[model samples]
Target: MNRTGAALLLVAGAGVIAVTLALWGQPLVSASGGIRLWVNSIWSPETSQQVADWYSVSHLVQGMLLALLLRALPLRRPDTVLLWSAFAIGVGWELAEHTDFVLDRFRATTLYQGYLGDTVLNAVMDYVFMLAGVALARALPVGASLALVAVLELASSLIARDSLTLSTLQVVAPQQAVADWQDAIRPARP
Candidate 1:
């Protein structure tokens, strides 16, 4: 298939996955009192050490794959645009998650115990990471620069959930965890 068709296919696939999960994904707090979490699951900060991967690992690699798909490649401008576009798209999803489309599902069912969209803090970091990715891509060959993402992502994961650089707010009723994460992160980060 052509580039446009392929891009459309990717987008359609993402939408399908999202809707399917939102519609049929298991409830966060099952009727029997068990807990479920997806995307990211660290019950407590102490117990879990962050992994070197998040969605971006796949995302960037997919971008490279996409780079193979298109012919109008600048290698620089496109990378920058792709970086910015990733940021914009992430922000958009965050926004969408907060809106009625996602909220309605949560209210009608317990697919997620608590459903909240990305916060401003997460939004800021997303941009930072996108810039970091763009800068890395500029400084080195594409794959090598992308490798830094794993290191950075891991280092970032080492941080407290509330750190400026490391922002993960997953657990429900996690104010204490958030506080602890905040406390744990501040001294080292400062």
Candidate 2:
């Protein structure tokens, strides 16, 4: 699709996400009625309320992976398809992530015990971040893109004790050993 068409598609997707979140009783911003550019702690109540957090890295990786997957398909217009597919995937994930089933699953199996759904702003920004990842994947060589993914996964895991890879593994197949290791780094609750 043309640049204008792609931009319109993304804007429409964001609108849908925001409306859905509001319908689901998600606030437009934090309870404090403020918007933050970033929240560093994955354990913080504000993590998913803010515009960006460590899991934002995971969304970026999702975009890259989606782009790669679409490109691998035999579509005649891979670039155009990538944009549509990424939008669909990002919107679908945001909608699904807020559901009780997914939220409860994450709470039970992952480090996100305090997990609530993202605020509208954060969810929209996540879609934007995912688009950024698509851009990154298109700009770099395949090997470089893979290298960057490795670096992002390793760094996020090392810094936060969680990453996309770890989160996926925990959700798909919970392990007491890994949970213990992740919980070891968590600050004690008051």
Candidate 3:
């Protein structure tokens, strides 16, 4: 993508993030310090719903992967292709997260025992985060983009509570050890 296209994506991303914050109107979760650009805790019971938490990283990684995957396809205007894909995937996931079945699935799992659905503001922010990732992938070198994807995946899991890869693994396979580990971090309440 050209500089102009990348700049536009950045502007659009910022606008969406701003709109999300405006819509939130109030902080959903109050951390000890306050809303931050990034929080290290994965499931603090305090900062989970804050502006930037562990699961927030998942959205960005998802966008990077989706953008990369879509770009791989033989399509002209790859950025446009990515834009539509992000819309469909982002909206679909937002709707899915609110569904009873998906919420139950999350509740049954290790990572999200207190698995209430996301707030509308958080949901919107999540979509915008993905857009940021898409823009990053388009603007950065392939190696740098891949490196970022790697760093995000690792940091989220190691420094926080969950990650895209771990979430997908637990969802698809439901491993005992992973479940045990997650339980160790924040045990499920009765």
Candidate 4:
């Protein structure tokens, strides 16, 4: 694609993703990624270790892969450009979650709780993963683009929130209370 065409495409894609993220907040889950990706509810040894390990490794792997993708871009090579793009996109999604009428309706009308919304740390990880991906692209399996995507996804399984990590980390709340509160509540019958 021509530079102008590519730029427009990027803009359009970003706009759509931003609008969607602002509308549809994504989910986060890990083998032990807290009760609700809050980071606070994680205490059990296995779960906590798993959460930490997952986030640490996943973020690294994802970041490298993102780096690769960014490298493939036909645009100017600027570090923050890709990272900030990711941040903007993540923040947009957080906002979208609150605005999406359907999601709002589902939570309000249907049975969903603790959808208190997202935070900035989520955006931070977006940048981190973007960096990771970019780094990977710089050096990897020659032509293993698909391989990169798979590794990133696999790493994400550790902390499977909408983005690479959860937003709860952005807002610091003590784990004790989070665990107690989460434990006190029971899930609604599906």
Candidate 5:
């Protein structure tokens, strides 16, 4: 199979897995009930399922990073490979989020306070969001891609009270200061 073909298969497979997770009882959207394309409505000041939410940008950043990693490989088209790789990673992440260990950690930690997990629709959309990032990284020069990631990360922090780095820090270290600041700023869940 060619790289593009394989990449497409991987994406399809990941979609199937996400659907399975949803059917297995994962929420599809708002705990109350909501599903949207393009963007999620603002549930709170700090949180939204917007198509381009901070979390969605995180997926894009992940795609950019993945593109950088795949660039090391001597593939015919590294972008294609990166897309599939990002999809695989995204699927794995979604599955992991549904696991007891990850969920328990969120419950224990301040970073993901009140976090249950992504809904089926959101999980699927996240993969799409990441793919969009991968596309951007592939289309732009490396420097530009890096710049984009930086901009997105900065915007996410300013608007969402969280970014990839902030979330990572909270998860890995769990600092009270970070948690307090985020808590104070994040919108209260309805």
Candidate 6:
């Protein structure tokens, strides 16, 4: 399929996913009942309710990594397949993320003590951000993409005291020391 066709398909897929989420009783917006472009505090109740948050950075990185992975593989038309694959993965994660199993895991292990799943808007925007990442990876040099990933990772870590890497480690391993450090370093919630 052509690029525009593939993009439209992904948008349709996102629409279906959004409707499914609504049916599953997920809110289209935060409990605050507002539509925000960005929410600065990751610790706030509005964290995953808005269009963008710190975790959105991780999603963007996810796209870059997925695109790079597909490019490395001996697959035909990787560019054509990249968007669909990334959208499927993102939707899958968003669906699973709202499940009791994943939510419990995050609450038990990560700094997301009060963690709830993303709002529909946030979830959909995440896919968009990932697509942006895919475009970015295709546009920039390999070294540049990697450098951007490094910068984003470091910036998220320093700013939030938790990042995609740390969150993944916490879920997969759950080191007590790291959890304690995260709790200690977490800024006072508003």
- Best-fitting candidate, scored by lDDT: 2
- Model 2 lDDT tens row, 60-90: 9988877777766899988887888888888
Itemize residue pairs with steric clashes in candidate 5. Answer: 39-51, 40-49, 40-50
TM-score leader = 2
Q: How accurate is candidate 3 locally (lDDT)?
A: 0.70
lDDT per residue for candidate 4 within 1-190, as digits (tens), equals 3446434544554455444444454333333444333242222333222223234444455556455656667867455566555445433543554554634542442112334333233433433444445456556764775575666554453333212332232222224443344334333435
lDDT of each: 0.39, 0.87, 0.70, 0.42, 0.69, 0.81
What lDDT is obtained when candidate 1 is compared to the true structure? 0.39
* Tens-digit lDDT track of model 5 for 76-111: 966566656776787778778778888877667675
Pairs that collide, model 1: none
Model 5, backbone clash pairs (residues 3+ apart or across chains), number: 3
* lDDT (tens digit, per residue) of candidate 1 on 1-190: 3456434544544454344334544222223343322224223321111222243333333333333332146555564455445545544543454566666553342223344432232323333343344444555665665465555555445632322123323323334454555445333322
**Clash statistics: count for each candidate:** 0, 0, 1, 25, 3, 0
TM-score of 4: 0.36
> Which model, 5 or 6, shows the larger TM-score?
6
Q: Give lDDT for model 5.
A: 0.69
State how far residue 190 of model 2 sits from its true place (Å).
Answer: 2.9
Off by over 4 Å in 2: none
